[model samples]
Target chain A: MTRIEEAIKQSKFQDVYQKALVNLIYTANCLRDEQVRILKPFDLLPQHFNVMRILRGRHPKPVCPGEIKEVMLDKANDLTRLLDKLERKGLIQRNLCPTNRRKMDITLTQAGIELLEKMNHMMEQTHETLKGRLSEREAASLSHLLDKLRG
Target chain B: MTRIEEAIKQSKFQDVYQKALVNLIYTANCLRDEQVRILKPFDLLPQHFNVMRILRGRHPKPVCPGEIKEVMLDKANDLTRLLDKLERKGLIQRNLCPTNRRKMDITLTQAGIELLEKMNHMMEQTHETLKGRLSEREAASLSHLLDKLRG
Candidate 1:
C-alpha cells in the first residue's frame, strides 16, 4: 500500500484508477499545506500569495482584475474581496484606467514587489524540498502523466 | 511544451522540477474544478461532500469535531461554521456526547447517506473520465511518483 492508502486507512481500492484518484487529491492537499506553511509565517494566504505572483508577473504593466481572474490557478469567486484585503495591506493599488474611467487597473506596490522577491526563493526552496526524492526524469514523467490525465 | 506551459503562457521553466511543481498545482486545481462541476447541481461544495464522506466512513459510530478535523483532506480552520452549515442543510446532526456534556458527537443523517448513495456512482464515473487516458500500469506509476514527490 502507498503512503496515501495508509493515511486514508483504505487499503482496498476497486482498481488502480480509484487508487490514483485518491493519491492525486491527497498529494495535492499536501503540496498546498506546504505552501500554507511557508505563507503563514509571512502572514499571507495562498490566494493572497497567488494574487501577488500574478501582479509580479505583470510588473510595470498594470493588469485588469478580469485578466488576473482569467489566469489565477484557483479561481477566486470573490476576487474583489481578496483585492480589498491586499489593498488594505498596502501590497497592491488600483487606479482608474486612463482609457476607460469606469475600469480600474491593478498594480503591485513597492512593498509587494519586495515581498515577493523575499518569498520567491524560499517558495522555490520549499518546492525543491518536497520533491527531493524525484529526479529530473521522474519529475518530467510525472508532469507528462498529469497532462495525459487531464486530456 | 506541455498544455500547462501554453495555459500559463510561460514556455520556459527553470527546470523540470519547477515545471513539475507548477504542473502538479495546476492539474490539482483542474481536478478540483471537475469535482465542483459535478457537485454544483447538488448544491454541495467539495468540503461539504468531504465531511459527508468522513461521516459515512464512520457510520453508526459518531465522531467528534476534532477527530473529523484530523482526518480531513483539506483542514478546515472554522469547522464549527462548516458543521453549522451541514446541520442547517439537515445532512448531519450533532448530539451532545452522552459521556461528556462538553463534547459533541457528529453523525450523518439518513438524508445524507441517501444523497451520497445517489452521487457516489456519478462521482466514481467522473473519476474514471478524468483518468481515462492512462492505463492501470500508468496510473500506478503516476501514484508512485506522487508518493515519492511528497517524500
Candidate 2:
C-alpha cells in the first residue's frame, strides 16, 4: 500500500481539514486528465490552449510576450520557446513591437481562431459533464473558497 | 487583452468556466512551486517525494515497480527513467522479485527515510500556510465538492 493508500485505509483524519487537502489535489489531477483528453483531439496541451486564449482576447490588438506571461495560467519557464512552437505550427504570429525593441507582439492566426471555435463546444461539453456533479451555487461557493485559499 | 482576459472582462459563461479552469491550474501550479522550493534544498521533485512515500509505505516488504505506479498520485510516463534517477542518487534500490520474473521490487534506503523526515515538516508547514485561508468546514466542503465534481 502507498502512503496515500494507507492514509485511505487508516481513516487517519481527526477532522475534515486534512481530508480537504488530499481531496483538492486528487480532484485537480482528475480534472486535468479530463482536460488532457479533450485537448488531445486538437493537438493542443492545456498550456497551448491557455496561450491561444490569451492571444484571441487581444484579437486585433497585438500584445507582447511579457504581458501574456503575466496573465498565463501557469507561469511558464520559457515563453520564447513555447511561442516558437506555436508560431512554427502557424497558429500564431509574432511581431516586434514598434515602441519596445525588446518586446514582441503575438497575435493568433485565422487557423488559431478557427481551432479555438471548434474546440469551444467540446470544452463546454467537458465543463457540463462535471457540472452535473455540483449545483451552480455549490460551484460558485467552491470557486469562491478556492480564491480565498489562494489569497 | 488576451482571450482569457477578455473572457474575464466579457463575463462569458463559457469564458467564466475557462477562467475557473485557469484558476485551478494556476493555484495548483503555485502550490507545486512551493513544493519545489521545499524539495530543492533536499534535491528532490514532487514526483520524487511521491516515490519515497510509496517506498516508505511498504517499508519492510519490497514493492514492485508496477505496484508503485498503481498508487502514484501522478501517473508518470517513464517509470524506468525515474527509478534509475532515484537509484543513482542512492535513495532507493531495485531488485527483481523472485515470485514474479517481470517484476522489480523497490526499497528505500536509510538516506531516503532521513531525507523524507526532513522534508515532511516543510510540506506540513506549507499546508499550514494555506490552511489559514479557509475555515475547517469550508475546506471540508470544498474537498467534498471537488471529489463529487471529479466523480
Candidate 3:
C-alpha cells in the first residue's frame, strides 16, 4: 500500500484516477504544511511569501495588484488586504503609477528584497529536503506528469 | 513549455529538482482552486467538505475531533471551531462518549449524510474534470510520483 493509503486508513479506491485525486490533495497539503512551518519563524504566510517572490522575480519593475493576482498560487486571496498587510510590514510599497494615474504600482522595498534573500536561502534547503527522495530524472518525470494532469 | 510556465510566466529554473518543487506547489493550488469553485454553490469550504467526508467514510462509527485531525488533509485547522460550525449547520453531532465521559464522540447527522451523498455525486464529476486529461496508466503513475515525493 502507498503512504497515502496508510494516511487516510483506506486501501480501496474506485480507480487509479480517484486515488490520484486524493493523493494530489493530500500531498499538496503536506507540502503546504511544511512551508507553513518553515515560514512561521519568519512571520510569513504562504501567500505573503508567494507575493514577495513574485515581486522579487520582477525586482525594480513595478507590478500592479492585478498582475500579482494572476500569478498567485491561491487565487482566492484578497489582494488588497494582502497588500495592505505587506505595506504595513514595510516589505512592499504601493504608489500611484507614474504611467497611469488611476493604477497603483507596487514594488518591493529594499528591506523586502533583503528579507526575501534571507528567506530564499532557507527555502533552498526546504526544496532540497522535499525533493531529495526523487532522482533527477524522476523529478523531471513528476513535473511532466503534473503538467499533463493539468492539461 | 508546460502550463505552469505559462501560469507563472517564468521559463527558467535552477534545476529539475527546483522545477519539481514549484510544479508540485503550483499544481496543487490549481487543483484546490478547482475544488473551491465546485464547492462554492454548496456553500461548503473545502475543509468543511473534507470533515463531512471523513464522517461519511466511517459512518455509524463515531470519531473524535482528535482522530479527525490525524487524518485531515489540512492539518492546521482549528478543529474545535470547525466542529462548532458543523454542529451549527446541523450536519454533525458531538455527544459525550458513553465509555469515556471526558471525551466526545462525533458522528454525521442524517442531514449531514444526505448532504454528503449529494456532494459525492458532484465530487465524482469534479474528479473526472480534473483527471480527465490523464489515462489510467498516467493517473496511477501520477499517484505514485506524489507518494514518492512525500517520502
Candidate 4:
C-alpha cells in the first residue's frame, strides 16, 4: 500500500483506476504542503505566491483580474480579493489602465518582484529535492500520465 | 504543450520535473472541482461528504473526533467543527461514549447513509467516466507512478 492507502487505513481500493484517482489528490496535497512550508517564512499563502508569480510574468506590463484568472491553477481563488490583499501588503501596485479608465491594471511592485525571486529560488530547491525522489525518466513519465489522466 | 501548459501560459517548463510538479497540482484541483460540483446539489462541502464516508465505514459503531481526524485527506479540516456541522445537518449523531465520559462517539444517521448511497452512485459514474479516459493498464501505471512520486 502507498502512503495514501496507509494514511486512510485502506489496504486496497476497488481497483487501480479508483486508486489512481485518490493517489492523484493525496500526492498533490503532499507537494502543496511542501511549498506552503517554504512560503511560511515569507508570511505568504500559497495563493499569494501564485499571484505574485503571475504578476512577475506581467512585470512592467499591467494585467487585469480577468487576465490573471486565465492562468491561475486554483480557479476558486478570488483574483480581486487576492489583489486587494497584495495591494495592502505593498507587494503589488494597482492603477487604472492608461488606455482604458474603466479597466483596472495591476503590476508587481519592486517588493513583489524581489519576493518572487526569493520564492523562485526556494521553489527551485524544493522542486529539485522533490525531483530527487523520481528520476528524470520517471518525472517525464509522470507528467505524461498526468496529462492523459486529465484528457 | 498540454492543457496545463496552456492554462499557465508557459509553453515549456524548466524541465520535465518542474512540469510534473505543476501538472500534479493542477490535475488534483481538476479532480477536486469535479467532486465539489457533485456535492454542490447536496449543499455539502467535500469534507462533509468525507466525514460521512468515514462514519459509514464504522456503521453501527460510533467513532471519535480523533479517529476521524486520523483518516481525513485534508488534515486541516477541524474534525470537531465538521462534526458540529454534520450533526446540525442531521447526518450524524454524537453521544457520550459509555466507557469514557470524557470522550464522545459519532455515527452516521440513516439520512447520512442514504445521502452517501446516492453520492456513491454519483461518484461511481464520475469515476467510471474519468477512468474511460485511460486504459486499465494506463490507470495502473499512473497509480504506480504516483505512488513512486510520493515514495
DockQ of every candidate: 0.59, 0.43, 0.65, 0.70
Candidate 3 on A1-151: residue-level lDDT in tens?
Answer: 3478997777798889888888988987777887888888988899999999889889899999988988877763588998898899899999999889978899999999999888888878877776668888888888888898888
lDDT of each: 0.84, 0.74, 0.84, 0.82
Q: How far off is residue A120 in model 2, in Å?
A: 1.6
lDDT, candidate 1, B1-151, per-residue tens: 2478876666688789888888888888888888888888888888888889889888979999988887777888999999998889898999999998888999999998998887787797876675568988999999899888877
lDDT for position B119 in model 2 = 89
Regions of model 4 farther than 4 Å from truth: none
TM-score of 2: 0.89
lDDT of 2 by residue, A1-151 (tens): 2233242343455356666666566556766787789889877787888888888877979988888888776778798989988898899999889898898989999988998888777878877776676676766676677677776
Candidate 1, what DockQ? 0.59
TM-score of decoy 1: 0.88
**Lowest-scoring 10 consecutive residues by lDDT in candidate 2 chain A?**
A1-10
How high is the lDDT of residue A47 in model 3? 93
Give the C-alpha interface root-mean-square deviation per candidate: 2.5, 5.3, 2.3, 2.0
Query: Comparing only chain A of model 4 with the true chain A, what is the TM-score?
Result: 0.91
Fnat of all models, as shown: 0.72, 0.47, 0.76, 0.80
Candidate 1 C-alpha lDDT tens digits along A53-80: 8898879899888888877778788999
* Candidate 1 Cα errors over 4 Å, as ranges: B99-103
lDDT of 4 by residue, A1-151 (tens): 3566886787778888887887888788888888889989988888888778777776798888878887788863567887888889899999998898888999999988888888899888777666768889988888888887787
